[model samples]
Every structure is written in C-alpha cells, then in structure tokens.
Target: MTNVFEAQWEASQVEAMEALRAWAVAFAELNQQMSSWLDLPTTDANALGQVLWADSSGDPLSPARLGQRIGMTSGSVTVLVDRLEAAGLLARSREHSDRRRVTLRPTPAARERARAFLEESSAEIAAAVQGSSAAELATSTAFIRKMAAAASGATTRLRAARS
Candidate 1:
C-alpha cells in the first residue's frame, strides 16, 4: 500500500518523464526545420553548432577535439572538414605553435548565417517556453540538466564497457 505522498511523487515523476520525452522530440523536430531553413545538411549543421559552442577566442578547433565532442572518428572529422571547406562554409589552417596541427574555423559568411539562424530559433524556443510559469520553467530546466548529465554519463560507461 503506497502512502499518499509517495503516490503523488510517483505521479509527478511520471509527468516529468513524459514532458522530457516530448521536449526532446519537439527539439529534434525543430532542429531539423532550422537546419533545412539554413540549407545545411544535418551533419554539417550539427558540426557547425558544435564549433559555435566550443569556440573560444577566434581560433578554430583541433580536428581531434571536434571529433571527440561530436562523437566522430578522426577520419570522419577530416571528411567533414573537407566537405565544409569545399562548400566555403569553413576553412582549415595550421596552428601557429604547431604547423602539423590543423584547425577548422567557420568562414565569415557561415558565421553571419549561423548567427541569424540561431537568433530565429532562439526566438521560437523562447516563445514556447514562455507559456510556462517561472517555477515550472525552473523545474523543467533542472530536470533537463539532470537527464542530460545522466545520459552523458551512461554513454561514457557504455563506451568503457565496450572497450
């Protein structure tokens, strides 16, 4: 026999899980649309997004680092960079400290386009979240962070297990 408090907590957990799932689905769909709008292939768009997020200062990312962040192999990252460079969306340069190391950076045009696309997407997502109360938004945000951390940890454990 479950106590009333326990039953309510279980119900809240269920609701939170359902809401998280729905948000994930919706975000994926929205990302697809935004990629289409930007005329970027999903892989390229994702790579671009990673670059935008991980970029510190104006320097490009090392291919190895980018690959690690995006879960791609070095070979695949090379291919991805090749395609992006060919499209004039990004360029590669040798690091000053190490001529042997190549780094990938977005072109000026790509940066402008990415910024506009992100602004539009941010507006859309903001509008959606605006429908929620402040408390609900805070709860959802914390729940999302918790879930993301758990997923990331699980992925790491799975990789270690496979190895």
Candidate 2:
C-alpha cells in the first residue's frame, strides 16, 4: 500500500499542498487587512511594503524595479508613487549622477505602522515554529527556498506561454 500510494496517489502530498494553499490564503488575507487598515489601495500598500523591505535591507529600490517586481506598468508605477508620496507613506529622490532616476524611500511613520501590522502574525509564526529542532528548521528552510525558486520558474514559463 505504501509503495502504491507513493507511486500513484502522491500519498500525503495532497495534504501538504492543502496546507500550503491555506498558508497562501492567510498571507493574502494579511495583505488585504493591511491595505484596509492603511486606508490605501492594495497596490499602493504592496508598493510601500516593497519600499520598506528594500530600505530595511539597505538597498534603495527604484520605481522601475518595484514596478517590475509587482508586474505594474511604468505609467501605473508613476501614478502609484505619486499617490503614496502624497499620502506621506513614501518619498522619492533623484539619483545624484542621474537626476532622471528616481528611487523610493519609505517614511519612518509608514515603516513603523507596517511593522506594527505585521508584528502579531510574526509572533504567532515564531511561536508555532519554536518547537522545531535546528536540523528540522534547516530542512524546512531549504524546502521553502527550493519551492520558491520552482514557483518563480513556473511563473516565468507560464507568462512566456501566455505571450
């Protein structure tokens, strides 16, 4: 039964997939809630999140790069940035060498609010995973990293196929 299940049923794989789907839904809900709480459009909240993440990572993200990451058009990104800047959630600065090049900067107030929004979920996740051994956590990290890469490649292939 084990061999047949492994070969034909994909065994417990479907259960794992169901869990992953639920996790994905939870993440989407988090984004939706964050957007609502911020009184911002989902797209704008996503853009601000990207800017905050980049700034925290010590890498300044440009509008073009953020648009590319979020699959938004240049014109749409321009409009989004304008709206965010107007909302005091973000600021833009021109590159010293290339005055035409604009980079996103998250306001401290916005970053603090974003972190506050995420804190409860972060704490929950930490508590849930706290029982994992070092080796178990390492294995989970590797699995998730590989899954992310595979998912990214699948998205690229799907986009190309659509094109």
> Best candidate, TM-score-wise?
2
Q: Residue 63 deviation, candidate 2, in Å?
A: 1.3
Q: Candidate 1, which segments miss by more than 4 Å at Cα?
A: 1-9, 56-60, 99-101, 128-141
Regions of candidate 2 where Cα sits further than 4 Å from its true position:
1-9, 129-131
Show pairs that collide, candidate 2: none
| Lowest lDDT block of 10, candidate 1 | 1-10
lDDT over C-alpha atoms for residue 161 of model 1: 100
Q: TM-score of the candidate numbered 2?
A: 0.82
Model 2 lDDT, residue 96, Cα: 62
Candidate 2 lDDT over residue span 1-163, tens digit each: 2564456546477776676799889978888888987889898888888899898998889989998778898999999999999988899988669898888999988988897887755777787699789998998789778888988897889989999
Which lDDT tens digits does candidate 1 get at residues 1-163? 5665455467768887788889879877876876797688877777877776655366458889888777999999889888888888887878678799877777887788888887877886777788889998998688788998998998999999999
Weakest lDDT window of 10 consecutive positions for candidate 2: 1-10
Model 2 RMSD, rounded to 1 decimal: 4.4
Report the error of model 1 at residue 51, Å. Answer: 1.0
